[model samples]
Target: MRGGKALKHYVVDAYSTIEQNRLYYLRSHQENLWSELYYGLTDDFNRVDVTGDNVGHVVLPSSYTGSPRYMKQLYLDAMVVVHHHGSPDLFITFTCNS
Candidate 1:
């Protein structure tokens, strides 16, 4: 369970709103770190997207992949898996309700 609520639900809209707000709180708490993140980085941003990099920096968890604030979570996850598992040869996706 997350934030006292189950992840999957029929009420997607409510769940998404709650989750978004929760993440907003999390990210907002990190607002003070923005300047520190960009302090010595660079005036010339390297990312191709303007909208995403405007916020400076907010480290995202791996589970936030494909969401609005993806923020290199996929790259982070890939690096972790490669470091621990010695590179993957295959990937599989499946869904089930029990």
Candidate 2:
């Protein structure tokens, strides 16, 4: 939010087994610095699964959403974490059409 730029939008498409996908999201959002409300929401829905081609959109503050290097690092980190959680064959695609 400190960037003073407009929010950036992205579409994420993930293909994997339900359990694998669930684990991917769980690990991706496992950081402890999130607000209490966010923790509660994640805890409440920890068992949810995404079957087949799961697609969703997210709006991120500009300061945290740009730069290819940063995005690539995030993807790499996510893959590493998710790999440790379960399947090593998870596929994720991110698209920004804005």
Candidate 3:
């Protein structure tokens, strides 16, 4: 739960949008873990993909294996792009190797 709040804050700071922040939270944490769980619990949430729509939650596959440093860097890069694009929205696609 603490992890989820911390992650949510990071996402909110990165995206500066409530919807995007919630999306990131949905993707990163379990349904039971989040306080304001959106969409539903224990089922995949269908995300909106149109331009300017908030990118909803995502779940990475269990097979991803990347160093925490690398994952953080990747997330940071994505944040930069989102900040630049002003959307901070993305579909969660699990990379084969993180």
Candidate 4:
């Protein structure tokens, strides 16, 4: 429903960002950044059943936690989710709890 549409939009936007920033976001040895973003979003979309009533939870792996660049990217991803789905009830793994 609405939530699914929202998630889809978010994924599309993430893909767009990766596509637009190919050189800047590339990893060491010239790896494409788009694959990671695409796989992550698609995997989560497939794993979770997002609905209007239930909240969609996106858990970033521990690897993405400390890096500033990754965090910035995550922030952008989150904005897309919020823009479409409204403020979620809770955000667990993304924040620093230290």
Tens-digit per-residue lDDT, 1-98, candidate 4: 56788899999999878765643434332333334644456666677777875453333332454555578778988999899999989867766668
lDDT of 1 by residue, 1-98 (tens): 46344435546878789889967966887655345443324444553456854765664443564654355656777799899989678888999999
C-alpha local distance difference test of each model: 0.62, 0.50, 0.56, 0.61
TM-score of each: 0.35, 0.24, 0.25, 0.25
TM-score of 2: 0.24
Ranking 1 against 3 by TM-score, winner: 1
Model 2, residue 57: C-alpha shift (Å): 31
Cα lDDT, model 4, residue 30: 32
Q: What is the lDDT of candidate 1?
A: 0.62
Error of 4 at 51 (Å): 54
Model 2: pairs clashing at backbone N, Cα or C within 3 Å: none
By lDDT, the better pick of 3 and 4 is 4
Off by over 4 Å in 1: 1-10, 19-35, 38-42, 45-71, 92-98
Best model per lDDT: 1
In angstroms, the error of model 3 at 21 is 39
What number of clashing residue pairs does each candidate have, in the order they appear? Answer: 0, 0, 1, 0
